[model samples]
Each structure stands twice: as structure tokens, then as C-alpha cells.
Target: MQTVNPQTILKEKFGYDNFRAGQLDVINKVLAHKHALAIMPTGGGKSITYQLPAMMFDGITLVISPLISLMKDQVDGLNTTGIPATFLNSTVDGQEQAQRMSDLRHGVYKMLYVAPERLEVPSFFSFVQSLNIELIAVDEAHVLSQWGHDFRPSYLNILPLLEQIPGHHALLGLTATATERVRENLQQLLQVTDENTVLTGFARDNLALKIIHNQDKRKYVVEYLRKNSDQTGIIYAATRKQVDELTTYLNKIGIKAARYHAGLSEKERQSQQEDFLYDESPVIVATNAFGMGINKPNVRYVIHYSVPGNIEAYYQEIGRAGRDGLPAEAILLYAPQDMHLQEFFVQKSEGSEEHKQNEYDKIREMNAFANTQTCLVRYLLQYFGETVTKDCGHCSNCLDTREWVNVTVDAQKVLANVIRMNQRFGKTMVAKVLKGSNDASIRKYEFLRELPTFGLMKERTLKELTRFIDYLTAEGYLQFEGAEFPVLKVTSSGAEVLKGQKTIQKRLEKIRIVSQSMNSDDLKLSDNDNRLFAKLKEKRLALAREAGLPPFLIFSDKTLLAMAKLKPQTDVAFLSIPGVGEKKFEIYHQDFAKVINEFIVI
Candidate 1:
């Protein structure tokens, strides 16, 4: 086994001319017999780092993944691309499992997918140990770290079992989301130093991350689905009850949808999953249990019905959409109450005091995420330890077109009231004082009413004032000081305002759905091209139905959209499309070129 030009293999086999961010570096590290831990974003081609290297290896590259349900689809997709691969899981019958294992032993397949649980099985371990395992690649490698949000104990058996395997040449650990701590743990487990570690950073340029604050989550989701009815997506809820309720409400409103959760029977869950994967159901409402390894790449959007417990889970869930390198969106419908739900979860989770405290810390970070007026993409990337200065123009924060309103008088009123109260209260109490509320707290502090700024903002309601206070806090004019009962204090900038050296202006309103669909270079299709894309979609759906596969696996939406725009008629021209590899052209070349030819005629 030797290293060759990975770019050539990428184009000839995987149907791409360029290697994504960290794919080539990680691939080369392993091909040089160096163990590497690669932290790449979801849908960033992490599989190719190992898959391409495995094709060049003389022996089988065993991929250990925890996602058992997605193994069949992955293996099927590889087989369609003319890459010989197989998987051994509970879904395989005893006879078929034996046959696959025999084939694996005889080097009939370049790669084999297996769950991490297989490493602990005695018979399976004995057989796998005897084979010529050239390389072992662990997918979702964050599960190996105890500090990760989705950690699993089953991953503990991986390194111990691999120690005895003789033919394995190198180890690659791949994950989409990992903090500084998680990366350190993975490097230690993979026995790779930081020198060989490749990190492409956690930034999805193709995803427009939007945080919809203080909106009716259900109504927004329903309307969004109705508007984008022809597209496919997933809506994630915080609880199974929310999933069921949302599913029922959407169906009642004449929108076809399905629900998936751990509470459902295995058969029912499987059916819902299959519906979403095959595009029979355009949308799925589920809890965090739904999307781990399902590779339905054409998901146009992912709506978070509620706030996720941590950034890791949220990023991974949103990463499911636009997997085929197309423009998509991740809209998180955030409300103040979403914190209470996550706080309840943090309290109820089983962990030691330190772990609970860590969960609470993550909750606070998510709270900032929902409220921040800064660049959403920069905030997320910074959370994952990536240093990014420029704000990504794709996120809602960057796309926000609302003009700032002058609020210098309001700021003076708020800052004066905070000082009069000795900066001892939070936003709620301070806002109440400004609004001249008749609440008991205001009454208890009788002298508070005598202050000039106490009743200055009485024209506005308490809720409006509090939201203004929140905006000021997010803008750094105010800061919270405590955890249990956080109290807001005027920041240094606030003092500047009091000294008349600063002027205040606020974004008076939260953005509505006016910018729901953003313009991206890759997603742009002319009106006529869009019509052709729709026709190609119908043809793809029909072909998928006949072949018993998801339409995206046949040809991604990105590829179809490109073909429609270009109107390539010849077989050679069709093969020149971005997603068309040698094998893909060999299989579906005529089928797709005919559609473009027919469309071009009209």
C-alpha cells in the first residue's frame, strides 16, 4: 500500500475535483502510517479522508461507527459509486453476516462498516483480529471522550481491542463537533500528538444560521413548511411530547409530516425514519434521538423547535441539512422560556456535581447565543475554540437589515435608575422600577420612587423596557454578575454614556420572516432553470421509487440544479457535472442526460 494523488481519486471515484477543507491533510497523514485525529465539520467529507486512503490500501479499512441504523444506507451509497464496501450489523441475517465476513476476510471489499459494540464481541473480535485490517477509522470520535455531549461507554473498548490487531497500519478519529477538551481526549486515545492533528475549524459557510427570538414556534414552523412545501427538512423538538404535539398540529393543518422519538415503538420509529429518508415524508419532528448518522444529503432546512441542551448537539443537528454542499438554513426558534426547559434537563440529568455545573455552564452559553446581536457564525465558531474575526454574512445576525434607533434618552433613564438602585438588581426589577410598577419590591424600596429616573420610562410597558435592557446587556452597556440570581451592573461603556461621552441606539425590533430565503451563489437558479430543476426532481423521484433508494443518493439536488442550469445534453458534457464520477456516469448517465435533452428541446 502506498500513497498516490488523492485529488485524482477524489474526482475519478467520488465525483469531486477538489478536496474539502481538511480531507487531504488527514488522508495523507494516515497514508504515511501516521495516526491522526481529524476534527472536521459535519458534511465536510470526513469519510473521504479514510475512504480514499482505504481504497489505496492493500487490506480492508474497518470503520467503527456507533450509528448502526445508517450503515446500510452508507454501504449502499458506496456500492452505487462503484466502491466495493459492506457492513456487519444486527440488521444482517446470520447467513448473510457469515457470507459478508467471509468476503471481508478474503479482501473482497476495500472497507467494512461496523459498530463500536462489535469490538467487544468475542467471536467477532477473534475473526476480525485474524484478518488483515490495514486501517481503523472511528466515526463520531467525540463519543470516545467522556466530556463530550454525546459520549458513550462502548467506545472505551475500541483502543483496547485494536491493540491486539496485527495488520492495522494507522488510526484515524473523526468527529464534527469537539471542543478543546474533547480534542485533547481524542488525541490521547488515538495515540496521536497535536502535530498530526488536523482541524478545519467549525464553520458552515453554506448554512444560514438564524435565531428566531420571541416568536411563536409552532406557527412559524407551520408557515415555513407551507411556504417551502416542495423542499425536505427536519424539525427538532426538545421533548417527545413536543414532537408528537407538533407532528399532530402540522398534520391537522393539512401538512403531511411524521414524528420520531425514543418513546415510539421500534417499528414505528423505523417507518418514520424511512419516510423522511425516502422523501415520502418531507419533514420529521423528533427529539435529539433522531439524527446521528442518517446521510440524507438534500435536506433544504433544519428548524429547531426548541433550544438544544448544548452547542455540540445543536451544531450536529443543524449539520444534517445541506450535506451535499448546497445552500441551506438552520433556524432556531428561541424564546426566553427555552432556557427553563434546558435548565430542567440539566437538573434532571444523571451526573456528579461538577458535570451538572458544566451542563449549567453550557446552558448559559446557549442563552447568550439566543440573545447575542453579534455575528451568529462568529459566536458559534468562537465557542468551538476557532478564532474568527470577520462575521459570516450568511447568518441572520449578519443578514439583519434593521436600522438602529436612537435611544440616548432611554439609556440615560435606565442608567440613572440602575445607579439610584446601587446596581443591585437584575433586568426585570430595574425595568419594573423604570415603568413605575406597583409591585411589592418597588413598594418595599420606598425611596426608589422618589428618584427622578424611577418613573421616566412609564410610557413603555415593563416587557418592552426589559427587552431594551436585554439589548443593552447584549451590546456590552450592561453586564450580569452572578449565576444563581444574576444582577445587572452598568459596564464601563454605560459609565461613558452617563458622562455624556457616548450615545445609545438600539435595533428596535426583531426581524420577521422577510429574509427567510437568502441569496447564495450556488443556490441561484434562473426561473427557467428552476422549472427544469423541478422536472428533474420528478424524474429523480420516479427513478428512486423504481430503484428503491433515496433520490439524493441517485443525484444530489445540487448536481441536478447545476445540470438544469447548464442544460448539458451530451454524455461527455453530463459527466462534466460536479457530482458525476466515472461510475455515476456509467450507471445514470443516459437516464439524466435524456432529462436534460428533453428539457432543452422545449
Candidate 2:
């Protein structure tokens, strides 16, 4: 690869000192007219891959996107960075769009974003053919593959339009997630050969992976948010209904929050989004629809209320935080029921039997990461084909104080029982039979009367036995045959263990000791003190509403909490609270002092 002085361009145009990993190499390849695919995590500067090259090339760069809101956000962001950019989408009226097209013909735009449907119009095609086109960038390019999670039919027809462009401009495809199969589909669809392949390693070192297993997920989420108050964050739910419920719960608890989903009107979505960006609201409860082009820099946390369908989706969702090079948290609250929800998605997708089975198996593998007792970061890296020998120490599992025991004898007995039962039963029945539950299903199968290991293993609970099976699955000693009513199938490793040729060690997951004293320093605040802070916030909100501004704009919750705790009795003391700007001090300093004096005298 040829080297260019990226520093010069970075300083002159983007006001940056250097390029991120693999960015310079990809830019050089695209400028040389080689079609390429770039796979970088979200917030990894994928936009610059095509934007910088557009500046050096001869003609305009056309960016194809799926969301109008995302297009507007990108155009607005680029304009702020001193780049001459525009968008042609339905959000603009006919006259405005026509004027944009006229500007394009006159070479007024260096970068133009358009929706895939807009390319279907013949006039648009004719107009594009008349320009000196430089590059075609397909954002969210995974949508082109049927194997991907979010496939769009419009993307399938995009290649023909690329063929119609007058000049030989380079083609660039970008997405956060692409398995081996999706990568192949992208290459065939874009007609790119092997020589142009550009695969950036998918490891996101800055993110810490955590998985919390609990039956009552809402309770855990509420408790976490209460403890982490005064931080900007986002919570992603799988459905719009869940978003609504979570938004209500947060608001009732006095968190400045809003909801974003496709079910809302465009105006509502815009209003909520503006409030979030301006810090008028510190938390946004949203579905998957809210995060494509959001570029907020200081989001401190991303909490998943449900398990996403695949690891790719999980990675993309969590990538929204820590963009400003600060430490941020990604928390996953999972339950065994989440697997059923993911399986429903696999069953609903369109594919042949073999393809569907393959997708189902992939989901199982992704879920296995959640059930593992090893380091979470190591498991995530290994999924993307990177190896890490040492534990990250930051993940939940590495910090856990779990106990390990040699379950080799137990595993062998379980396998012998499965073979005795003819290897035709699912996990539920197998677990019941192993624990000697004598449930109706097990009794109907008559496994209760078997002699291999039926009633002898009655001491362990069903939950424990199932967890042990998951451990065996993770260790390659067992496999779940994905078919109609999938059942457990012993692998060669399992057979070896059954014959005493191998040993398997099982570690019991550690139980976290819930601190009875909620006043611990780590929790930040006690329940009663939090409620008192909420009361103070109520007064602040009323004042802000009277002033016709946001409560945070008046004074943040942190400022109010400080007031409630320290009882600042003077202007100087009030001004010392966090987020109290000069204007806020001028407006509400007297009111806060009055409250403090009243509390002191009482």
C-alpha cells in the first residue's frame, strides 16, 4: 500500500492529528479505484473512510442510507466540521430537493446523502449520470445480505444503479457486523474480488463486557439506574412496548427521560432526540430504531433490558457509549427466557431449511457467551477470531469469586443416562430425569423406572443440572442438535469423559452478596437520600417550567442533589455546585438560598 501524508489532510480539513486504526490504509485503497469493504465498530470513524477520499477525488461522493433522520444527522455533523455536504430525501419538500439537485449539477456539494428508494426515480438517474461521480458509499451495507439481521429489499437493487453511473468510481461497503457468510454475500452483490478485501479486526478494546443473570430484570435495572444517578445513559429494549414501560418507570422515579421508537411520529422523535442531544434529558429509553446515526460524545452507560438476537447486534448497541475516550459501562440483564425470544426471531426469518438451521445454531453460539464462566472479554474477542490469553479483570466473570470442582464423574453419569434414555429427549426432560423430578413429562416417558442414573441423582436442583449442561455445551463436550424439538447429543469429548478417558471441571457461578447497607460508598446514595434529592428536583423542575426552559438547563440533578445534601446558604456556595452556570446562578440563586435557609432554621 502507498502511504500518504494523512496528517496534513487531518490538520487542514478535519482538525485532527491522526487517523484511527486501518483508516489510512482503507482511504489509500479507495482513492486508487479499488472496491473495498470496511468492517469497524460503531464510533470507529467509518464515515471518514469515504468522506476524506471524496475530498481528494475529482467528483461528488453519493452516500446511500436507509434512514432520513440519519441522513440529516450526518449532513448536519459534516457541515459543522466545515465540509460542504447535503442530503436528498423525502424529508425535504419538492422545491428544496430540486434545488439540491440543481446544486449537485453545478458542483456545489462535495458529499451528498440519498435514500435507496430515491435512486429508483428515472429523473434522478439521468441527473446522476450527468455528474462527475467519484465514489458510491453504502452505509449499513449488511442490509444487502439476506443472511444479515436487517435485510432490506431496496439494497438488493442498488448494484444496478451503481452500474449506471457514468464514471468508474470506487464502491465502498461498510457495516459493524458481518459473519463469514455475510461477507461473501457482500462481495458477490457489490462484484468485488478478493484483492480488494479490507477487513479491520473487530476487537473493541475500550468496551467492557458484562452479563448479569436474574429472574427479575426490571428490579435489577431500576436498582442500577438509581445508584448511577446524575449520569447520561441509554437503555435499549427489544420492543416498543418495553420502551414505553421503561420510560414510564424511569420518569416515575424522577429521572429525566424520554422514549424513541419507530412507532412515534417524526415530530415526536425529533423533539425527544433534540432534548437528549442538548442534555435537557439525560436518559433515553429506546428500541433498536433510535441509534443509527446518533453521535453524542459523552454517553456514560448503555443498558440492555433484553438480550439481542445475535452478538453483532449486541456489539453495535453497546458501541454507542464511551465515544469521547472516557470509561463507560455496558450492562446486559439476561434470563434463560431471552433465548426463547431470540429463537422466535430465527423461526420468523425467511430461508431454506438448511439456512434456517445454520442461523439457529449461530444464535445458540452467541447465547453461549452469556452462559460462560470464563472472562467475558475473552469470549467476545474469540468470537471475532482474536485470541486473548489473560483475563481482562474488568468483566463480571473475572471479578467473580466462583468455585470450581471436577464434574468429570457427574458428566459421565449424565451421558450414560442420556444413552440409556435413547438420546431422544430435550434438555427439560433430560434435566428432570437426571434430578429425579418425577414430573408428568418424565413419568409419561417412563424414565423414572430406568436404572442407569434415574433416581440416584435426585439431590441437585433442575436449575443446577441445566446450568451444568450449558457448561458442558460451552466446553465442546456436548452439542444441542438444532431441529424440530432439539435434543442434547453427546460429542466425542463427552463420550471420552463417559469412558473415563477425559475429565471436565465445572465452576459454580458465584452469588453476589447484596449489601444490606445501601449506604455503601459505591452505590453513591441511599434510598431515602435519593428520594430527598427527588423532592428537591421537583422544586427545580417547577422553577424551570416557569422560566420556559429545561430543568437541566436551569440546574442539573447533580446540582440539586448537592444543594439537598450541603444546604448551600449563599450565592457563592450555590455557584460551587456542579453544572451551575453564571446564568443559572443569576436566575435561581435566591430561590436556592431561601430553601437552604429554611432547612437550616427548621
Per residue, candidate 1 scores C-alpha lDDT tens digits across 300-402 of 9999999998898999999999998899999999876777788788777776766766676677667767778889989899889989999998788888789
Error in Å for residue 422 of model 1: 9.1
C-alpha lDDT of candidate 2 relative to the true structure: 0.78
User: Which window of 10 residues has the lowest lDDT sum in candidate 2?
Assistant: 514-523
lDDT of each: 0.84, 0.78
Residue 528 in candidate 2, Cα distance off native in Å: 21
Best by TM-score: 2
lDDT of 2 by residue, 1-602 (tens): 12546567677878878888878877887888878988787888888899888777768999998878878888988888877899987789999988988998898888989988888889887887898888989999988997776777667886888898987788899888887778889999988776776777666666677888754676677667778877888899888988987787566545668889999999999999888888899889998888887889888889988888778788888889887768888998877677787788768877678667766776777678778888887887677656678778888888776687888888887888777777777777777887877667876876456756776578888887887777778777778886546888888989999888998876665665653312325336566557657667877888988988888877776667666666665554565465665556767778777766755565
Report, for all candidates in order, the number of backbone clashes.
0, 0
lDDT score, candidate 2, position 533: 72
